[model samples]
Target: MVVFNAPFDITLINAELRRHDLGSLEERLGAETAPVIDPLVLDHSLDRYRRGKRTLSAMTSVYGVTLQEDAHTAQVDVSMMLGVLQEMAVRYPRIAGVDDGALHQFQVEEHRKWADNFGSWLASKGRVDDISRAWPQE
Candidate 1:
């Protein structure tokens, strides 16, 4: 599934599914875990040179997504996300053709790289705390 923030949304969904005795999402996917396309990770990887925030709104603006109204609702947010993905695919065509497993693995590596860079930057700023590089949690 494609999501803006895979970790947060997947965690909440898995927790609720587990609470209802529906089994974990991974089990339902017939794999170790569900395949996910994380736009946040993709954006960071593709536009590492770009500046400013990476919020959904910020991304929509960067990708030239036109919002008819506020994007507080899930429907609006999802639509905007799809639009952003479309723009990304146009700019980075290989992303659109990657197989599910390969795409999932790519996101995993990208997330790790982003985390490591962020940790190092934090260290450069005098914060010497360890950063958890785990993706989508355990």
Candidate 2:
């Protein structure tokens, strides 16, 4: 599965499924979620020093993707996100070269590192925010 923010979307999906007594995505797949690509996570990890927002719209602009005017719609957003991923892979060969399993694991660790660093930065500013380290789930 390819998603802009896999953690948020997958967690929401699992929540809704649990509300209805349906199995979570991982359960339905009968294994740990693998081969899921999150463009937002990839872009954040790969371009760590890039300035400005990492919103889907911001990424589209960064990657030269033509975002449709009605981009908040699911179909349009997904298309734009895929375009961003393609451009990311082209610009960063490691993204394209890595296997899916490894890529997923990489994102997990990268998210953890990001969360820790961001949390520390927030604390330095005297903010008491809790950033989650969970990836592709929470």
Candidate 3:
């Protein structure tokens, strides 16, 4: 599965599945959620020092992908995300060179690092937000 923010989307899907007494996506797939690609996570991890927002729209701009329709609609967002991911692969050969399973694992660690760092930053500011370190399914 390719998603912009796999954590948010997968979490929401699992919540709905649980609400209806169904298996989570990972369970249904009969394996851990390997091979799922999240462009947002990839971009953040690969381009850690880039300035400005990392929203889908912003990323599309960064990747030179022209969004042909209004943003936020499911179809439009998916199309733009794929476009952005293609551009990412072109610019970041490492992303294309790694296998999907390895990439997924890399993203899991990257998300944990990001959450820990961001949570520490929040704590330093006296805020108590507990950022989740779970990736792709939390």
lDDT (CA) per prediction: 0.85, 0.89, 0.88
Best candidate, TM-score-wise?
A: 2
Off by over 4 Å in 2: none
User: What tens-digit string does per-residue lDDT give for candidate 1 at 1-138?
Assistant: 888878778878888999999988887777766477888989999899799999888899898898648786898999999999899999899898988889889888898898899999999999984766766653
lDDT of 3 by residue, 33-122 (tens): 767899988888889999999999999899999966689999999999999999999999988889888988899999888888889999
Residue 4 error, candidate 2, Å: 1.2
Kindly report which residue stretches of model 3 are placed more than 4 angstroms away from their true locations once superposed: none
lDDT of 2 by residue, 34-66 (tens): 778899888889999999999999899999999
User: Which model scores highest in lDDT?
Assistant: 2
**Which 10-residue window in model 2 sums to the lowest lDDT?**
129-138
Off by over 4 Å in 1: 18-23, 27-30, 128-130
RMSD of 1: 2.2
